[model samples]
Target: MYQKKVKESNKNNIFKYIFEKRKSFVINDIAENLNITFPTVKKIINSFLKQNIIFERQKVGFGVGRKAMEYELNEEFCYSIGILASSTKLKFILTNAIGKILKQQIYELKSNNCKAEILNSTKDFLNTISPEVRKKLIGIGISVPGIVSEEGNFIEFSSKEKIVLSFIEELKNLFHIPVLIENESNLAAIAEAFLTRNSIYSTFTILTINEYVGISNFHQDSLNNTLFFKAGRLHHMVIESNGKLCECGTHGCWGTYVSDKVLLNDFQKYFPSIKTYNEIFDLKYHETNIGASLIDNYLEHLAIGIKNILFFSNPEKLIISGNISIYKEYIADKLIEKIYKNHIFYRGKETIVFSSLNENGSIIGAAMFPILDKII
Candidate 1:
C-alpha cells in the first residue's frame, strides 16, 4: 500500500509540474523540478504515453551525445466539453487541456427550469461533435450561475438532487470520465487567471456584466468560489438603496443599472425590432444610438459598484468581462477615470482592465476545469 501511494503521488506531482509549465519537458527536467526519482519519472512518462495523455513533441540535445525526447500534453487527446446553463441560453465550448478553444456554439433555452430539456439538448449537442473527437474527450465540465459545492452541483441552492445531480451523472455516463461543475463566476475567475499565468498580478478580482452582474475575487492558486450569492447578489448590492426596480423585486441593485436588461429595455424603446446585445452594440453607429445615449448614466452606476467592490475586496487587479467588455474601446479610459476620481476608500496599486477573453471567459473556464482536474 505504501509503495502504491508513493508511486501515485510521484506520478501526480510530476504530471502537475509538466502541466503547469505548459511546455515540453525531458524526464530529467520533470525529476529535478519535482524531486522524483529518475526511474519513477521514466515509469510515469511511459504510463502517460500509453494512456495517450502526453506525447513526444520532439528530441532536444542536453549537451550529451544522445538527445532526450521532449514530452508534452497531447492537446488532441486531452480535450474537454464545457456547458454553460443559464436562464435564457445553453452555450457549449470545446477546448483542449490548456483551454485553447476548438469550437463553441450557443442555443436559446426554451425553458430554463426544465431539466429534461437541458439534458436532451446537451445529448444532441455532443452528438454534433465528430465521432473521432468524442473518442478523445477526457471529461465534461459544467458551469452554472447558481452557487454550488466544489463537487460541482447546485445542491446548496436547493439542496436537492433533482435540480442538477442527475444531470451530472448523465454526463459522467456519456463520457465514462469525470463531470465537474462549479459556480460560473468561479470558473470565469479561473479562465481569466489562467490566461495571465505568466503575468505579475496573480491575485485579483473580476467583474462581468450581462443579464446580471458577477463579481469574483481570485487569490493566487485559488479556484474556490467563496461568496454567499456571489455575483448574483452583487446585482442586489443596492448602490442607490432606493433606485431602479429589479426583476427579483428589489430596488437599487447594481444589476438594475448595468445588466443587459437595462440596455435591452431601453433599446427596445427605439429599435423595438432588435433584441440582443450584439444587435444593439453592433449597430452601424452608436454616436447617435440609444445604446450610445445611455453611456454616461450607465458608466456612473457602473463606477459606483466597481468602487464598492475594490474598496471591500481590494484585489490586486480588477477586470471587466461579458458583453461589457465589448465597450472597452469606448469606455475603458472613461470608466477608469470615473472609478478613481473622488474615491476616498480606494487605495491605488489596483490594476483595472478588460479581459481579452471577455465574453468567452465562463465557457472557456468551464471546459478547462476538467483539464485542471488532471493536476489537482
Candidate 2:
C-alpha cells in the first residue's frame, strides 16, 4: 500500500509539472525540472505514451549522451471547429487540441441573403471534412461581426427573421455540441493579446478595419477570465453634427469619415476606374502617391475614433487587426501621435500592438476556443 501511494504521488506531481510549463518538455528536462528521478520520469512518460495521452518526438543534441527525446500533449485525439462570419465572407476552419489547423475554407457571401447563405456555407464546409474526423468534434466557436453575450448568445439585432429569430438556437439543436458565439473584434483582441510578449491585457480595445470598421473592448479578470463583450461602433460615434450621412441612419457618424468604405470612395474619386480594394492594393505606382497618402489619411481618421475609446476604457493596450493591421508600423505611430495631440492628460503609455496571427486570426482564435477551454 505504501509503494502504491508513493507511485501515485509521483504521477500526480508529473502531471502538475507538465501543465505548469505551458509548453512541451522532454523526459530528462521534465525529470530535472520537477526534481524527480530519471527512471521514474521515464516510466511515467512511457505509460502516458502507451495510453496516447502524450506525444513523443525525436530530439538531437551535440552533448554526446544518446540524444534525448521530446514530448508534448497530443492534439489529434480532440477536435474543434471555428467559423468567422463577416459582411463580405465567411471562413470555416478546423483545429485540434494543440491549435493546429486541420482544414479550412472561405466563402464569398452576400449581405442581402446572409442567413441562408451562412447556414449553407457552414454545412458545406463541415461536409468537406471526413466523417470520421467530424465524429470527434467537441464544440464549435463562432466569430460574428456584431455583439454577443458572455454565454455565446447573439444579442445584436439583425434583419433576417431566421437569424434574428433563432438561427443560433437551431444550430445548437443541429450540432448538439457546445456552440460559443463571440464578437469578431473580441476574438481579434484575444489573438493579438496572446501574441504580445509585454503583458496579458485584461482590459483592451481592438479595432478591425474591413470594408466597415468594427470595434470591441475586452475586459476580464485574468488571462483565463471570461471575456466581456461590448459593442464599440466607432463608425457610428458622431464626429460632426452635420457631416456625412452614415449607413446606421445617423448623420455625421464616425463611420462616414473613418471607414475602409471611405478609403474606397476616395480611390473611386481619384482613379474613377478602380473596382475593388484588391485592385488598389495591387497597384505598383500607387506606392508613392495614392496608396501611401491614402493609407496615411486613413490612419489619421482611425486615430480619432481610437481616441474616443481611450477616453472611456483607458485600456492598457490597443490592438489593431484585419487588413489595416498590415500597415501597422505606419498607422500605429500615426494613431499614437494623434491620441497624444488630442488628449493632453493621457500620460499612460499603453502598448499598441499588431496581430501576428495573420489576417485569419479570428478563425484561429475561434478554433482554439474549444480546445483551450477543455484543457484548462
Candidate 3:
C-alpha cells in the first residue's frame, strides 16, 4: 500500500510538471527533467493520453535520430474562471488547463449596487462563454483587494465589501464547483512565481501600487506566514510621523505617497488635462518638466517605502506590479537607482524587478488556484 501511494504521488508530480512547463515535452525530456526512469515516464504519458488529459503533437527531429513525439496538456480538458473584484470594476477571465486565458470580460461596478452588479455581470459572463468551455470548467477563483480570512470565507477590504458571505454562497450555488478566494496581492505574487517558474526569484516581495497600495511576500514560491493579513498591511505603514492624512485615518502612511490616486493628484496640479499614469509616463519621455518632477517625487517616496520594506524583510528581489508596473522600464530603473543611491544597506545586493505578468497577474493567479489546488 505504501508503495502504491508513492507511485501515485510520482505520477501526479509528473502530470503537474508537464502543466507547469506550458509546452510540449517528449518522454525522454520529461524523464530526465523530472528525474524519473524512462519506462515510468512512458507509462505515465500513455496513461495520461488514454485519459485524454494530454495529447501528442507533431514530432520534433533530434539530430540524426528518429523524431520524438511531443506531448502537451489537453488545454480544453478543463477550465477555470477568475474574477478580480476592485473598487471600480469586476474583471472576469476564463483560463485553460495550462493557464492561458481564453476569454475576459470587465464590468464597471458601483459602490451602492456592488452585490447586484456582480451577480448580473457574472451571469452575463457565464452566458457568453461557449457551452463546451462551460462544461469543462473545474472551478472559479475570486481575487479581492485586502485581507482574506485564512479559510478564505471572510474578507476585510479597504474599500466597500465587494466579496461577502452572501456573494460567495451565491457563486457556489450557481457554479457547484470548488471556489477559491484570495487576497489580490497574494494572488499577484503567486502568479509571478508560477508564471515565471521562479526565474524572477524563488523568494521575493511584490508591491502593487494602484488606487490603493498592497504588499505581499513570497518565499520559495509560497506566501510567507509571517506577512499574513495584519503583518502585510503595508498601505497603513507609517512612513511619516506627521505627514499628510490618509483615508485609513492614519498620518504618513505609504499609500498616501505612492498610490496612483496620489500620483494623479500631484500630476493634475501641474497638467490638469493629463489623465492616466500612462500619459504621465509618456510625457516624461518627452522631457516635460512637470512630468519629470512628478515622477522624481513619486520615485523618491517609493524608494522610501521600499527602503522601509528592506529594513524589515530584506527580500532579495522586489517586484513592483499593478498600475505602476505598466511603466516598468521607467519605474524600475528609477526605483533601483534611488535605492542604490540612498540606501547604504542595499547598495549592490538586492535585485529590483517589474511584474512580468503586468496587470493580469492577480486574475491569472486567482484562476490558477482551482487547478493548482488539485495538483499541488
Candidate 4:
C-alpha cells in the first residue's frame, strides 16, 4: 500500500513539474526533463488524461520522427477566484488554471470600512458572476491589503481598519471549496516569480508602494510563501536610531519613511495644487526633482529594508512594484544604487530587477492558487 501511494505521489509531482514549466509540454521532453523512465512517464500521462487534468494535441515539428504529441493542461478542468482587497478598492477576478482572466469586478470603498466593505463586495461579486463558472471553481484566493494568518485568514489591517477573519470561513462554507488568503505583497512576489521562471535567481523580494507599503519574499524552492510572509511584516524594523515616530510607536519603522501616506503628505505640502497621484504623474510627468527627492528619500529607507532582508534571507533579486512603480521608470536602478552606496560591502550586484508583472502581479498570484489546488 505504501509503495502504491509513493508511485501515485511521484506521478503527481511529474504532472505538477510539467504544468509549472509552462502551460504545456510534449511527452518525450517531459520524460527527459523529469528524469523518469519513458514508460512511467507515458503511464502518468495516461492517468492524467483519464482524470481530464491534461489533454494531448498533435504538432508537426520542423523535423521529427513522428507528429509529436503535445500535452497541455486542460483549461476547462478547474477555475480559481482572486480577490485583491486594497486600501482604496476591492478587485475580484475569476480565472482559469492558467491564470487567464475570465471575468473581473472592482469596487471603490473607504479604507476605514474594510471589514464590512470586503464582505459585501465579495458577496455581491459572487452573485454577479455566472453560476456555471462559480460551480467549476476549485478554490478562492483572497489577497488582502493587510497581514494574514498562516491558516489563510485575514487578521490585521494596514491602517486603523481591521481585517475581518470571519469572511474567510464564510466563503469556504458558502462555496464548499478550499479558500486561501494571503497578504497582497506575498501575492505580488508569487506572481513575479511565476513570470521569471527562466531566471536562475530563485529567491526574490517584492515591495509594493501603493496606499501602504507592502513586502513579501519568495525562495527558489517555492516553499518561501508562508515563511517569507511571517518574516516581512516590517511595521517595526528599527532602521534608524533617531528617526521620525511611527504609528506603531517605533522610532523608525520602514513604513514611517516610505509609505504612500508620507509621500502624499509631502506632495500636499509642496505641490499643494496636485489632488491625486495620477494628476501629479500627468501634470509633472515626474520631471520635478521635488517628487524625485521624495522618492529618493523613500528609496533610502527602502534600501535599509532591503539590507535587512539581504542579511537575513539573502535573496538573489529584489523587485519594486505597486501603482507608483508602474508609473516610475528607473526606480529599481535608483533603489539599488542607494542600497549599494549606503552598505559597507555591496553584495547585491545586478540582483535587483524591475517587476514585469505590473499592477496585476498580485491578482495573477492569487490566480495561481487554483492551479496549485488542482494539482494537489
Candidate 5:
C-alpha cells in the first residue's frame, strides 16, 4: 500500500510539475527539478508517451553527447466544455485536455428565462461537437455568479434564480457525464493564472469587476490544492460602515461601490443614454468635469476594495479581470494611481495588472477544471 501510494504521488507530481513548468522540458531536467532518479523519470515518461498523454518534441543538442528529447502535454488527448453564466452574459467554450480553447460562442443575457438560455446553449454545445471529439469528452465545467455549495456542485442562490441546483442536476441526468461547478470568480482567477503563471509570482488574487463582483486566489499548481468556493460571498463584504445601500439590503457592501452596475448607474445620472460600459470608456467623457469627478470617485472606491484585498490575502500579484478588462488600457494609469494615491502607512506594495486573457478567463477556467480533474 505504501509503495503504491508513493508511486501514485510521484506520477501526479510529475504530471502537475510539467503542466506548470515551461513547455518542452527535457526528461533529465524534470528529474533534476523534481529530485527523482533519472531512470525513474525516464520510465514514467515512457508510460506517458505510451498512453499518448504527453508527446516528444524536437530534440535539443546537449553540446557533448546524445541529444535529449523535449516533451509537452498532449493537448489533443481529450476535450472539455466550459460554460460561463452571469446576469448579463452567457458564454460557451470547447477546450482541449490542457485548457487551450478550440471553439467558442458568446451571447448577451437579455431574456427573462435565464435557465432556459443556459440549457439551450449547453445542448447546442454538446450537439455541435464532432463524434470523434465526443469520444474524448470527459466532463463539463460550470462557472456562475452565485454562492456554490462546498461540494462544488450545488448553486444555492444567484441574482436571477433562487435555486439552480435542480437545473444543474438535470444536466447530469440528460448528459450522463461527470459535471463540476464552481463560483465564476474562483474559476476566472484559476483560468487566468493557469495560462499566465510564472516564476515571478506564485500567488495571484483575481478581482472580476463585472455588473457584479467576484474574487479568488490562484497558485501555479492551484489545481492540486483544495479550494472552498466561497469567493461568491466575498462580493457582499462591507467596506464602509454605513455607505451606499446594496440591493442585498446591506449598507457599504463592496459590490455597491466598484461594481459595473453602480458605475454605470452613476454615469447615467450625468449621461442618461449610456446603456453599457462601451460608451463610458470614451476619452471624451474623461474631459468633462462631472465625468472626471465620477471616474475619480469610482477609482478611489475601487482602490479601497483592492486595498482590502491586499490587507487580507497579500497575494504577490493582484489581477483585474472580467468586463472591466475590456477597458483596462483606458483606465490603467488612473486605477493604479488611485490605488497608490493614499494610505502611505497602511497599503502594501503589490504588483497589479490587467489580465491579457480579458473576459474569457471564466469560460477557460470552467473548461479547464474537468480536464485537469482527469489527470489528478
Candidate 6:
C-alpha cells in the first residue's frame, strides 16, 4: 500500500512539473529536472498519455540518433475557476490545467449590497460559465482581500462585508468541487513566483498597492514558512505618531498615504476631471506643479513603507504588484531613488522590482491553487 501511494505521488509530481513548463518536455528532461528515475518518469508519462492528461508531441533532434519524443500536457484535461473579490469588483477567470486563462469576466458590486445579493450574483455568474469548461473543472479558488479562517468557513473581507460562512457552503454546493479561499496578496505573490520559475531568490515579499495596500511574504520551497503579517490590516500600521485619522480609527497609517484612493483624491484636487492613475501620469509627464508634487509625496510615503518592510524582513526580493504596477515605469525609478536616499543601507541591494504578473497575478495564482494542492 505504501509503495502504491509513493508511485501515485511521483506521477502527480511529474504531471505538475510538465504543467509548469507549459511546453513539450522530453522524458529524460523531466527525470533530470525532477530528479526522478528515467524509468519512473517514462512509466508516468505513458500512464498520462493513456489517461489523456498529456499527449505526445513532435520529436526533437538532439545531436545524433533517432529524435526524442516530447510530451506536453493536454491543457483541456482539467480546468479551474479563480475568483477575486475586491472592494469595487468581482473578477473571474477560467484556466486550463497548465494555467492558461481561457476566459475572464468582471462584475461590479455595490458596496452596500447585502450578503444574499452578493451570493445570488455570484451564483448567476457561475451558472454562465461555458458548459465545456464546467464539465472538467476540478475545483474553485477564491482570492479575497482579507483572511479566511483555518476551517475555510469564515472570511474577514477587507470591505468588511458580512460574507457569511453560508456563502462558502453555497459555492461548494453549486460547484460540487473542492473550494479554497486565500488572501489576494498571497495569491498574487504565488502567481508571480510561479511565473518567475528561474528566479534565484528563495524568499521574497509581494506588496500590492491598489484601493488598499496588502503585503504577503513567500518562501519558494516551503510556503508554510511564509509569515502572516496581518496583510490587510497594514492600513492600521501607524506611519505617523499624530497623523490624519484613518478609517480603521488609526492615525497616520502607511496605507492612508499610499493607496489608489488616496492618489486619486490628491490628483483630483489638482485637476478635478482626472479620473484614473493613467491621467495622473499624463499630467506628471507634462510636469504640472500639482502633479509633480503629488507624485513626489506619494513616492516618499511609498519609500517609507518599503524601507520599513526591508528592515523588518529583508527578503531576497520585493515585488510591487496590482493596478499600480502598470505605472511602474514612471514610479519605480523614483521610488527606488527615494528608498536609497532615505535608507542608504539598502542602496546597492537587489531587493525591489515590479511584478511581472501585473493585475492577473492574483487570479492566475488562485486558479493554480486547485492544481497545486493536488501535487504539492
lDDT string, candidate 2, 247-322, tens digits: 6766887777766668777777777777865555654624758777876676676777777777766667767777
Deviation of model 2 at 165, angstroms: 6.8
Off by over 4 Å in 5: 1-8, 57-66, 107-115, 151-154, 157-160, 164-167, 198-203, 217-232, 239-245, 268-275, 313-316, 342-347
Model 6, 113-185: lDDT tens digits are 6454446666776688878777788888888777665555567676455465566667777658878777777
lDDT of 5: 0.75
- Candidate 2 scores a C-alpha RMSD against the true structure in Å of 6.8
Q: After superposition, how far is residue 352 of candidate 5 from its true place, in Å?
A: 3.3
Ranking by TM-score: 6, 3, 1, 5, 4, 2
Give the distance in Å from residue 153's predicted Cα in candidate 3 to where it truly belongs. Answer: 5.5
Model 1, position 218, has a per-residue lDDT of 62
Tens digits of per-residue lDDT, candidate 5, 48-158, equal 999887888778765777677899878787889998877766778888876778988887766757667777777877888999998888899988777676444357436
lDDT of 1 by residue, 76-104 (tens): 76678888866777788888777888888
Better of 1 and 2 by lDDT: 1
When 4 and 5 are scored with lDDT, the better candidate is: 5
Better by lDDT, candidate 6 or 4: 6
User: Model 2: which residue pairs collide?
Assistant: 235-255
Colliding pairs, model 6: none
| Model 6 misplaced regions, further than 4 Å | 1-8, 62-66, 111-114, 151-153, 162-166, 197-200, 222-232, 283-286, 342-349
- Residue 32 displacement in candidate 6 (angstroms): 3.3
* True-structure lDDT of candidate 2: 0.66
In model 4, pairs of residues that clash are none
Segments in model 2 whose C-alpha atoms lie over 4 Å from true places: 1-53, 57-70, 75-77, 98-102, 110-113, 149-166, 194-199, 220-231, 282-285, 288-292, 342-345, 348-350
What overall lDDT goes with each candidate model? 0.70, 0.66, 0.75, 0.69, 0.75, 0.74
RMSD of each: 5.1, 6.8, 4.6, 4.7, 4.5, 4.3
Q: What is the TM-score of each candidate against the true structure?
A: 0.83, 0.76, 0.86, 0.81, 0.82, 0.87
